[model samples]
Structures are given as structure tokens and as C-alpha cells.
Target: MNKIFSLLTLLFMLIYLPSQANDFKAVYELAGRHFPWLKGKVDINPLENKKQGDAFTIEVVQNRLKIEATSTSAASRALDWYVKHYAHQSISHMGNQIKNVSKLPLTNGKISQSSFVPYRYALNYCTINYSFSFYTWEDWEKELDWMALNGVNIMLAPVGTEMVWYNTLIKLGYSDQEAKAFIPGPAYTAWWLMGNLEGWGGPISNEMMQQQVTLQKKILARMDELGIEPILQGFYGMVPHDLKKKIADADVIDQGNWVFTEFKRPGIIVPTNKQFENVADVYYDELKKLYGSDIKYFGGEPFHEGGKTAGVDVPKVAQAVQTSMQKHFPNSTWVLQGWQNNPSDKILAGLKKENTLIIELFGENTNNWERRKGYNQTSFIWSNVSNFGEKNGLYGRLQRFIDEVYRAKNSEFGSSLKGVGIIPEGINNNPLAYDLMLDLAWHAEKPNLDKWIEDYTVYRYGKRNPKVVAAWKEFIHTVYNSPVDENGKVLYQEGPSESVFCARPSLKVNPVSSWGTRKRFYDIERFKKAVAVFISASKDFKGSETFETDKVDFLRQVMSDKADLAYSNMVKAIEGKDQETIKSSSSRFIQMLKDQDELLQSNSYFTLNRWLNQATQFGKGLPDAKLAMYNAKAQITFWGPDNNPKTTLRDYAHKEWGGLLSSLYLDRWNLFVERALAGQTVPPAEFYQMEVEWSKKADLYKPAKSNKKNLARIQQDILK
Candidate 1:
């Protein structure tokens, strides 16, 4: 019997060995190919499986990572350590919830430190934006794979909604010319759908619209495979301003003037109107034809962004929109955004309690979360929209703000709150913010934040020293926890609104603004010590390819801040006519720009052409004299040329840089003209030859290096 058992065990081992080897090999290849930094350094440990009927358990471990997992699960138990150690309290709380629901088991141990994950799957509003238009398929695929690995189940897939609109407009007897005007350019889809702006960058091709629909279909198909739910746009009575021309008798509420333009604002066809109902039917029918009729939820708002709702009873209008929706699709829920005093009582008063859901946006700062209680007694989800307009390299809602939201939601009012969500206008900017936000969705309770951050450092860096951990903790408390004065009101700097130009009107008056002002609120001496420690810890990692990219990005931000503070102090000294101060400030500015240039050059694919154009226009040349005047004109013409109201330091810098570029080029041009007039013969027929060459070279703007790939690899490795 003993001999027979030994033989059986040997046979079982033979069968399992290859499968384990293959899995590890595939993981290894993925890490090595995508994450070049982990080339030969990542330690891979084969998982040991224990089977019980159809279900099986797998054990995996590396330095700090000790996790137990189920065979059929999408994510591993290793993720729990990342959530518990690296994520904010709110995020960790959400992660805990996911663990309970999935019934995944975890062991107490650290994991190799790296970035969070390599990719993210983002689902913006329907009829607004799709991945293909803004990002490459390679980018999207990587993000989707990462989403799957991270256990993202429900995604807001709003592709092909444009097709629904296109078909609806065509059926309504509107010509192609009229229909094209309603659709915006590729870059402005988000704002167009939100009704904040329109037709600024477009005259979109019908082919492009169709292409978006096709791409959306593919996205939905992939999402379905990954168990992600797609949110479709529902009929909310939105109509172009030209709709009145098509239907003279149609009852429509004037939406007022278009934002950032003098054009007539689009009208909201009253859902009570028979014409409106007819249009909605055609719209839904076309959508069903494309994506099927199985969609249970529809995301559309009666008063989106800041559109007017004149000549319509708010309650009546709300009832009509819901009634029209239910007629075609029963039990359909209207997902509304609780943004800036919207979905007023009149709208919510008539809607059925069970069939409506609201996303309470801007929950981090505004008590609108508490005061409105989600438009007064409606089931809502607490969502934080971290960055606005998807600006790159910006931060998100602070850790404490997240903590407060968690505490509030779990308190007496927790019943109304369904779950937590991240609703950023753009998703590609901050990876840490995205991961941390998602982590909160599954957790039921918060963790000790200081300890959690320490764990995150270990997981991100592979090996964490006390100094590195201390630096991060200080960053969380100071820069991440700084206060802001908005419109004379003091508030915690959290969410996208706090970081962008629209959020900082005073930046024109104060160029540096609040970049490093956090030091004033904390112990500068201690913070400097922490910063020094962090810098020292990272010094040896200069060429360690295994370094976490996101951490590197964070470090860049830290260094940038130091540079900015140093420059600001020097500028003050210059004002005082102190030679020492002038030298110090100039040195700091040059060094900061140099370091930034170096960091940007690290990645070969960095593209800063667009920014360069804006910066040049704002800061360089003879044309610069006309900038302030032009800027004011542009602002009045179309909301400051960028359709943004709140001007930023960057914007000011753009103006300044444009002046500089113009002056330099013009001076060079003048010098060439002088030489030509002095009878200096050259190959070119005219003195302007040099100017042409310079123009061509200067026009080809190049951006700094980006560490996106490195960051992604680090994140994925840490999660693993």
C-alpha cells in the first residue's frame, strides 16, 4: 500500500509540474517584456494547489507576499495585502467589502514593492468619449487586462451612443449638415455630452461617428467577457439648438446661450411633448438594434452640467423622461450626477424611489453630500471625481477627505449610500488615485493609515527603508493634506477642482500659488528631513530597472516642488536686490528645469508638441505683446481659447513663454536682415532663410520622457 501511494504521488507531481511551470513562465514573460526593469530580478514562486472537489486552493509567496487563492477567481489573495497596506482607509474599506463578497482568503505577509497595476479600463459617459479616439488599442488592451486582474466587475461603457443620436437625427428629417453640427470634435466629447460646451473643435466626419460606434461595440464585447457592466446613455430630452428649425411646433425649453461661445444653447425637448417621445423611441430602438435590449440602467440627466431648464415643470419633466424610458425598457434606472445643486427636489419628488440612482459627485469637499442627502432621500452612491478635464500628472482627493467620507457613509446615513466609485473626467493621469479609489469600493472598514502607507512603500519599492516610509507618510500629511483658500473660503485640497486652472483663479496673482505652501502649515524642518531621507533612499535605485515607476513619478513631483520653492525664495531675494538671492534663485530654476528635462527624457515616447504650442503662444515673441489682449479676446470668444474659465499658472507661463519665443525668433530674424543689408553674401537669396530653418525646427516640439510603462510594470508586480 505504501509503495502504491508513493507511485501515485509521483505521477500527480509529474502532471502538475508542467502546468505550474507554464503559468509562472507566462507571468514571467509578461513582466519581463512589459516591465523591463524587472528583467532578471523578480522572484517567482510557483503556486501550490490543494483541491476539494471542483474548488481548489493555491498558495503563492515571495518576500512580503504570502497569499492563498481559489482556482476560479479572477484576482489573487495577494491583492488584499496591497489594499490593506498601500491604499487609503476608504479604499481599503472598499477592498475589504470585495474580499467578503468574493470570499477570497489572504495571509499576513508583505509583497515585493512595485507600482500598483499596469493598465486601466475607463468607461466615460455615452455619446461622449471612447477609448479608441483618445488612446491606442494597445493602451486600451493593457488597461483592460489590468482591470480584469484587479477584479473590476462593473465598467461604465458608453460607446455607440453617438450612433443612436446620429440615427435619431437622420430619421427626424435633419440633413447631414445639421446632424454634424450636433456632434463635437474628438477631444471635446466629454464636455459636449455634459452640455458644458459644444462644437468647438469639430465638424466630425460621419465615418468617424460610425467608427466610434464600431469601436464601442468591440469595447462592450470585451467588457462582457470580463464581467464588466456597460452604462448606456438614456434619453434625457437633450436636443441641439437647431431642433426648433426641424420641428416648429415642438415644445422645447431654451437651454440659454452655449457655454464659451455666442451660439444659441441647445434646447431640451420637453419629454411631455409627443415629438420628444417619438424621438426617444427612435433613439432607443436604434440603440437596441446595435447593443441589444438587455441594458437595465440608462445614464442621462435632464439638467446636465449647467444647462437651463426654462418653460418646463421640473417634476413633470422628470416624470416624463422616466415614463418614456419605462415604456420601452421596464424597471430601468436613471443614473444621475448630483453635481452643483442639480436633480432638484422637483425632479426627484416625482421619480420612483426604487428605480432611480444618483452618483453624488464632489463628495470629498462639499457638504452637498450631507446637505442634499442625494437630492433628499434617494438611493445614491458616494463618488469622488478626482481630476477634472483629465489633466495629466495631477493629484486626487486627499487621504483624510477619503477617510471622512468613509466614516460618514458608514455612520447613520450609510443605508442611502450604495457603494463608492471613482468618477474622474479623465482616468489616465494618476494611477495611484485610481487604484486607491477602487480599493475603497470593496472594503467595509478602514485601516490604520500610517501603517497602511508603510506597507505600500514596501510593496512599491520591493524593499522599503525607514526613511522612504517616513517620507511618504510626511507627503501624505503635508502635500496631500494641505488646505486651500477657494473664493475666500478655506477647504481641504481634494479632487480635480482643487488642482486645475478652473480651481485656481488667483494663480495669475501668485505664480507659484500653492505648490509648496504646505510647508507653512507643517514643520518645515521635519518635512525637509523626510524629503532628504526619501531622496537618499532613491539614490541607489538610479539604474535598478526594478524601481516602481509611479513612485518615481511621485518623486519627480517632490523634486519639482523643492525646485519651485527654491526658485520662489530666490525671486524674493532678487526683488530685494540681494545678489546672493539672485544667484540662488537662478541656480534653482535652472536646476529644476534641468531635472524636469532629464526626467521627461527618460521615456522615449514623450510627446509635448501640444503643450509646446500653447506654451509658445503664451510666452514668446513680438506676438506676445498682443497676448494679454488676445487672451482677453479669446476668453470672451470661447472661454479663454481653451474653454476653461479658471486661468492657471501654466496658462500664465504659456503667455510668458510665447513672448520669449517670439522675441528670440524675431531678434534672430532681425539680425539676419541686418547682415544681409550689410552685404554679407550667403547661399540663400534672402536674409529670412535662417528664420525659415529655425521655424521648422522650433515647430517640431518634443515633450519630456514619460515613465508610464515603468510605472505600470511596478504597479502590476506589486499587486502580484
Candidate 2:
């Protein structure tokens, strides 16, 4: 009997070992694709389940990495451990590679660490449209790898939702044209999915719809293999506003337009109607046919962001939605975005407390979880949206990230807090902010900013230099620690202060966007000193990409700051009635913009050409390629339906990028300056015309990289 038991155990081991090994193949494949340097040097083994949170260990022998972890996600963290600690390399925000260590550090014994938190979530609804609307498969591969390495296990994955909507509508007897007209283009899908606006950015091509479905399968497959749970779009009774016209008997409410009247938002179907469950079944059935039924989370919001709910019974609709979701995806958690009075008391009253999760959308600015009683006793995830509209800026409430997550976990409702998340609207800037936020998931104790920044500087630039350290310290104290006015109940505000340099030339430019603030709460002079110190370190570390990027970045900030002074002079010239002064001041302002644009050309990260190019690539070799390019540019500039001449969304997604400065902003400046020089009120009509015309230009712009020697010379001049 003992021999028979041993033979049975041997058979069980043979069956289980490959499944465990397969869990890590995605991580190795990711390393092979992105970090080829660590190809044969990494080995990962699965650890048995334990009482503690997800744990990992790394033992370095010679140069090889032996990683042991509870799962594939923990193994990725272990790989990050070797890369950050043993290899002294960094894969920063926007996937910037900073490498310098020639050899991996030898370890005497295994180094082990365990996470205090179980879930690390990432992404915002706006992030889908703002940052990744144009992403292809290659882009998603790198992104999934980044999420794995950063230990993000739960992410909002709505890439192919357009196709899901299209297929479902067609199955319900709607024509192809009707389906296409209801779905928005790539850039506007987020708002459409949120029931904000529909059919604004597009009449999506059938080919593109099919392409998205195929792409999402690949994304879901890779995410599954990497141990990340994808939160897909769920059916929440939203129907196209025109569905009633098509179906004749459809029980759709006439939900009005969202923010802009020209853009019609989707209508809602009453959940009590017998047809509602039938339509929902078709939607989820179509979803499973295309994407499979292995999903663990479903995310959708009913009446999101002030949608009209006049005829709907809030709790009954909520209950019906949850019931349908559970029926389709058994035991799946419903992930809701806790933004601006969402998950209202009535809605919360209808949910199954154990199977629902709310993402506290603005943890850096508000304490919604505490104020709302842990979302009325339902589980919640603490998340920060530090950036908005993918705007260019260097700002974050750093200490808030450290304090709030810790405080929440210790609060009266701590037991209901499920995880921590980074839900930035745009994620191209503020690398350190994201790095620190993700690290909080694993750190058992509150981190000392002083010690953490010291280590960050070393890993960032591959060495510790006092000049760099001093600069970062000032950054932490000032821009990084800038205060928020929590007393004010402001919602829908634009991101961090917009750079005056990027604004349309105006003396009274209160803010760049309609809802943004122009206030600088920190000491500008100290920030300048910080920039100077970072620039001065170039002579010591010119070969470092991190240093080079920071040099261009600091110079950009210094120039942006100088714009305030330039605008002041321009206003003074107008007041004094001096044409030459006005001309000189305007000329100086334009020159400053031109000079900054040239300086920004030194780094590809700061180039507008890259953004436009990436956006255009979404429709490569397709008939709608030009239309896609037009959508890309229009979304960034005059986010339009130019039918209304008095739209307020102009410059809402403005970029401080290089090519845009030279072409778009430069043209706007020259026109504004010329009109001012001629003593005429600014021509809003002409400026709008210029913007619309610029969006139509099919000319591809690729700024040549300034030579390294020239970049070095320019860096020195900017610093001095």
C-alpha cells in the first residue's frame, strides 16, 4: 500500500509540474522580447500557497537569477528585484530603459520579500482613450510586460469592446450602418463606454472592428498567462439612442447628450423589461464566443458621470445588472469606478457585498472610501489619477501616496479595503511617482522619502551624485509635495498646471484648459535651482539616458517658467502702447517657443511627431488611414464637432510636444502676434479656421534628432 501511494504521488507530480512551468513561460517570453540581456540567466519556480501575501525570493549565483515565487506575478516582481537591485538597471515610465551595471551583483544567500497587499491594479477609463487608443499588438505586449514587472494583477482591459458592441447590436437585428453609427471612433470610445457620448469620433470601419476583436484575444491570452486578471466591459443595459427607432419596440430611454449637445450619448434599456435580459444574454454570449469565459472580473458603470436617470428605478436596475453579470460570469467580481458620487447609496444597497469592488478613483485628492463608509461596506480599491488628458507635466502628491494607502489599511474600514492602484489619465510622465506607488503594494512598512529617493536616484541614473541628489530632494519638497485644497469640492478639473508656453498667447491666461488652474503653489526660484543642479550633472553623466532625458525635461520646465515673464512683458508693452515693444515682446515669446521646440527635438520622448505618428499607425494601409490621422490630431487640439463655434474643449488635450510647437503652436502664435501687432481684437474665428486646417494636413512630420555634440552645447547654454 505504501509503494502504491508513492507511485500515485509520482504520477500526480508529472501531471502538475508542466502546468506550473507554463505559468512562467509568458514572463520568460516577455524577457526574451524586451530584456534579451537576461535571457538564459533567469529561472523561476512556483512556491506552494502560504498564509502570507504573495511572496518571492531571488538568489544570484555568478550572474544567473534563480527566482522562486508563489505565482507568475511574484516571479515578475523577483525579476524586477534582480534588475533594480542586482543589475542596477531601470525600466522607467513609458518604457524608457536605463542601464549601466556591467555585471549582476553576487548574492551570498537568497534575498526574499513578501507583499503586504494582494492586488495591484492599473488603468483608468480615460487612459484607454487618452494614452492607448492607438496601441497595436506590439504596444500591448510591452505594456502587459510592464504591468507584470510592476506587480499589477488587476487591470482594466477594454481594448476590443467596440467589436463586442458591434457584434451584439447586429445579432439583435440592427443593420451594420446602425451599429457603426452608434459606436464612436478609437479616440472617443472611453466616453461612449461610460455612457457619456456616442458616435463622436467615428463611424468605425468593419475591418477595424474585426481587428480589435482579434487583438483583444491576444491581449487576454497574454494577460492570463502572466497571472493578471482582466476586467472586461459588462452589460449594464446601455443601448444606442437610435435603437428604439430601429427595433420599433425597444424599451430605451432617451438619455440626452452628455457635455456637448452635438455628441449624443447612448440610451439605457429599462432592466424590468423582459427584452432587457434577452439583449444582455446576446451581448454576453457574443462576448464569450469571441473572448472565451475564463474572465474573473467585469467592469461597467450605469449612469456614470451624471448620466440622466429620470425614468429608471436605481436599485432595481442595479440589482438586475448584478444578477445578469453573476449569471453570465459566475462568482465574478463587479468592478465599479468610484468617481463623483458613483456607486450611490441606492446602487450600493443592491449589490452583493462580497462580490463587488469599487475603485476609489481619486485617492490623491479625496478620501471617498472613509467619507462613504468603505463604499457602504462593499470592498474598495484605493487609486490615484495623478495625471489627466495625458498632458505634459512633472507633478505628483508623492507623500499622499505613502500616507493614504497606509492610513486606509489601518482605518476603521480597513477590512473592506481590497488593494491599491495607479489610475493615471495619462502615464507618459512622472516615472518616479508610479515606481513609488507600485512599490507600496509590497513594502510592509511606511517608506522614508529621504531613504527611498536616495535609492531611486541611484537606480535612475546608475550612480549616486550629490548634485543629482540635491536636485531630487528639492523636487520632492516642492513640486512633488505641492498641497491640494481638499476643502474645495471640485470635480472634472484638468490635470496639473498647464505650461504657459503651450497656451495660446494671452496675457490673461488664467489657465490653459477651461477648468484648469494656473496657480504655482511652490517656490519657482527653488524649482529653477533644482533644474539647474540636474542640468549641471550632465558633464558628469552625459552618457546616461536618464540624465539626458532629465536635462531636456528640466530645460523645458525652465523655458516654460520663463514664459510667465515673457507674457508679463507682452502685457506691459500693450499697456504702454509701444509697437516695437509689442513686436519685440511678441517676437521674444515666439522665439522662446521656437527655441524650446528645438531643444525638445534632442529627445524622441518630447517630440510631437511621435504622438501623431503613433496615432496615424492605427489605420496603417487601411482606407480610413487619413481619417484616423485626422481623428488623432483633432482629438488632441480642438476635440471637436466644429458645428458649434463656441466649444470650450479646445486645448483640453493640448500637448507640449516638439513638432506641435513648431507647426501648430507656432502658427497660432504668429497669427495671434500679428493680429495684436495690427491692433485688432484676437480673431477667434480665424484661429479656429487655422486649427481646423492644420488638422487636415496629410504631411508626415519627423523632426531630425539634433546631433549629440549640438545637444551637449545646447544643454550647456540652457543651464548657463
Candidate 3:
């Protein structure tokens, strides 16, 4: 009887194991249908090891993969866990753990390459710059795929709020024209949604508004499939500025100034208004119809981004907004951005602590987090808003800031620091900074960055050597750790005010540009030696299209860096009055710019057109009050000297050159033209002649009135 029982048990074990393996295959096939890019590549083999126990491991040979338990039951629980949480089209886990790692090397490309480990439950805050309507299903799918593969499970998706607002406005008897005017253009949605400015570049078409609502539905659906939580924009008493036109008794306050534009700041509607209750009800009802009433959190603010409130009871307004939310959802939480001097004490004073959560956005610099620290009340996430509005630059929370945060989290304040989050305005700029930040979230203790970088390099590049590994380590230590120079004061490049310039010329004065400095600081000679070996090994595999593209990208980075370094040397030589050196350097710099332009133009994968456009706009004509419109245009593409360390002569020109020249030389030029044409027929050629002569005089330096104190004050204002 014992022998028979043992034979029966063996047969049952064989049948059960095979069925379990087949279950993973089924899940993979289902996931592949949606994420077609993962077909045939993702390994779904169950990891059978003494340590793994009953857990099935799925791996991707090319990218990171995440896994988790699907259910509580012991039998088939692990499989359920893997299917529910880990089985996704974009990211998979199987085979050797190392094989499923990222294979893209670090490069100074237009977009940064990043990956998160254990890849299952990470949240990615990729601030989409273009109009949300511009992104089609494919674009959103690809974005979610990238996020999923990199382990991003949380995202800020506020697309359909327009529908909610539209419905509310319609129910309030406002005409479509008035409502459409309140919504902004696609590019300016983030600011509008944040309640900073409204009706600026607006008058959106009904089609466009509907398109965003439809897109949000798709976005939310896909995010749900991949386990990414979407933070919808909540109503926080943000009403149309023109509300007074409809309601004679409406009370509102004007929000100060609109950043980067001359548009009138929008007014905030009083939440206490009887109309407010109706608007909230209609808005959330529409939201529920579209997205289902399963939301746990709503992200919105009163007097947000920069709106204002006059004759408003702060505590009452806060209570009303919270009360309205609960009336609809019962237990919804409000997620607020802990920006500079925002969510003032008065506003947060009367709110229930448990129903609110704050994201300590600038935690890298101001301890508004530690100071308020949940206002001695609620939970918060330690988040860093690294890039401002997807600006192209390298910056992050300082090492000391991270150290302090880590230490604080493990201390008495740990309860308040819920989890670390990446609240970047842009996600595609700095890969290393993000990877490092995310890594800290999972580990119990801090990692030895040097060793971790080595592993990261190997995983990113498929194969890594001693030289390449060494280069990455050097990059992390030198360029990444370089300090920013603020008006001749040296400050680490990891805080809110830190300059965007990645490296300094000699630590004496900050360099004018971030790009060239980083290139110069990197040991190019050593990098080339290692790259040569990589090129040789990759040469034969160049026939493969993907590999070929990767090779081109890698080589382009090398050439671009070399060009930047050459340009820096040229600039230095020019400053030193070394004519021969200047001539050689300028020639090289121009050639490199030309080559880079050509490379970008030729390669369909990436383009530097945006940067080039910015460079051109900055160098265009003189500054005039009329040119304020043009300056604003340039500001859209190029960051000003305010927070950017890389403020250049070009930037200064956009800000002051035109105005300064106009003030000093405009009178003389006009006089010359008027005199030259006095009493006789004036030809356009004569005006041009006068202008040429005036240009020479205008270019000369002149000592202006002593206004140092005023200028310093103006500079401070500019920074704000």
C-alpha cells in the first residue's frame, strides 16, 4: 500500500507541475496580445530553486521585470500573485535574473535611460508637455509599456477633468462658448489644471475637449491593466474668472500674475457660494460616469499654482471642499503639492489630518516638509520635483538631502514620510539621478553607489568591461557630484536653486552652458579607449536593426561630447585672447555643431531641433517691449537665469540686450535717420545706412548709472 501511494504521489506531482508551467505561458500569451512588443521575448519559465520555493519567476532578457503574490491561498497563490500583479506585457521576469536587466548604456542623449528594480510597484510621474489630446492610443500604450517595464505603477493622469468641468458648466446654464474659453490650449493644460492661470491660451474646440476626455478613458483603462494608479485632478473651488458675469452676487479674488505671460491671472470662485455645491455634484457625477466611482484620491488645490481668494474664509473653504469630496466618494483623500509657500497654514489648519496627504515636492532643498512635516497631522510622501515642466537639464536632490531624508525616515519622523516618490516635471532628462532615487526606496539600507553603478552598467549595456564600468563610476563621482556656482558662490548641484550647468570651467566661475562643461569634465580619452573595444565587439552585429540603432546612438553621444569639449576649449581660448587657439577651436566648434545637426537630422530616432530652435530664438533680434511677446516665446523653449546655472550671453541677450541697446542707442539711431532724411526724400537705404553706423556705436560699452542695489533687487525678483 505504501509503494502504491508513493507511485501515485509522483504521478500527481508531475501532472501538477506541468499545469503550473503552462499557466504562466497562458498569462504571457494574454499579456502579449495587449503588449505586442513583448511577444516571443519575455521568458515565463518558473524559477525552480531551493531558495525560490513556490514562487514563479518571469524574466525579460532585455529589461527589468516585477513579480508579486496574486492571492492569499497557498495552493496556486503564487501563480495568482504573479498573474495579477507581475504578469504584464511591457515587463516580464524569467530565466537568469541578470538576463532580465536593462541593456541600454548611459549616454548624453536627448532622453535619459532609467530602470527600477523588482519592477512591479513603482510609480512614474512623466509630465507630458504636448497637449494630452496629441497623444494617441499607441503613444500612451508605449509610454505605459516603458513605465511598466521600468516598474512604474503610479502616475499622474489628469486628462478627463475637462469633461467634468464642462458638464458642471453646462448644468450651471453657461453657454458652451463661455465654458470653452475657460479651458486652456493643450500645451498649457498642466498649469491650467494646477489652478495657476486659466483662459490664457484658450478657446479650445469642442472636438479637442472631447478628444482629451476619450483619451483619458483609454489611458485609465491601460493604467489599470498595468497596475498604475492615476491621480485625477480634484475640484478645489477653481471656477471660471467670468463667473461674476453670470452671477451678480459672485465673490472672487484675482490670482496675482501669470508666469511667463502677460495674461490676466484667473480668479477663484468662493466654495461657499450656493452654486458651488451644484457644480461639485455635477462634476463628480460626470467623473463617476466616465471613470467609475472607485477613486481613492483627488489632486486639486484652492488658490493653486497661483490663483487667489479674497473675502474667503480659509478654514471654511477647506472644509467645504473636503466635505464635497466625501459627499460623493465617502472616504476620498486630497493629494496636494508641497510647493514653495503653498498650502498655507490657514488652509490646512482646520482639515482632518487622516483624509489629506502632501507630497513634499521640494524636499531636496526647503524643509517645508520637515518644518510643516504634515502640519503635525497627516501622512506625506517624500517626493522630489526634479525637472521643472520637463525642462532638459541635469539636476536632483543633493546627496546630503537624500542622506538626511533616509536618516529622518528611519527616525521618529519616519511615520510621516510614507514613501519616496519621483515627482519630476520631466522624466526623460536624467536617468542616473532617477535610478539612484528609486533604488533607495526598496533597499533597507543605502547602497554602495560605486558597486551598484557597476551592476547597473552591465545590465544597461548587455555586456560591460572594466574600462566602461570605471567610466560610469567616474561619471557618478565627478560630473554627478559637481557643484553649481551661484553668483561666484559654490553650491552643490542637487537643490531647488542649483544651476543647471553640470560642470564648471575651473571652479572659479560657473560655465555659461551645462552641455559643454559636462563633456569637458568627463575623461574623454579613457572613454574612447573603452568605446573602441565595445565598437569592435558590436561591429559584426550591426546588421541587426535594433543593435544598429543602439550603436549609432552610442557613437553619436561620443561624437557630441567630443564636439562640446572642443567648443568649451574654443570659448576659453577666445576669452584668453589666443587668436590661433580661438581660430582652431571656433572652426572645430562650428564643425561639431554642424555635424551634430546633421546626425540628429539624419537619425529618425532622436532630434536636437528643439534645442537648436531655442538657441536660434535667443540669438535673434534686439529686445524691445514689443519683443516681449517674442521673449515669452523663447522662454517657452529656453529656461531663464532664474534657476538655471547655465545662463549664457544668449540668455542675457534675450532678457536685457535688446532693451539695453534700445535705451542707449535707439534715440541716436532715430535722430540720425531723421536728420539724414531731413527735408529731402528719404530712401529706405538711407535708414539702413544710419542703422549700420548706430550699430557700431551701440556695440561699444558704456558705464550706466550706479544702480547696483536696484539691479541686485531686480535679480532677486527674476529668481522668484
Q: TM-score of every model?
A: 0.68, 0.95, 0.64
lDDT tens readout by residue for model 1, 71-188: 2112222343333343311121011111111121233433332112211223445212311234334445555545544445545666556667778889988888777778665544
Off by over 4 Å in 1: 1-133, 258-264, 392-394, 482-507, 510-529, 539-548, 559-595, 604-720
**Candidate 2 on 257-366: residue-level lDDT in tens?**
76657567788887777778988999999899989998889998778877777867888988899899989999988899888799889888888888899999888778
For candidate 2, the per-residue lDDT at 147 reads 89
> Pick by TM-score: which candidate is best?
2
TM-score of 1: 0.68
Please give the ranking of all candidate structures by TM-score, highest first, separated by commas: 2, 1, 3
- Any runs in candidate 2 off by more than 4 Å, and if so which? 1-19, 98-103, 260-262, 484-494, 707-720
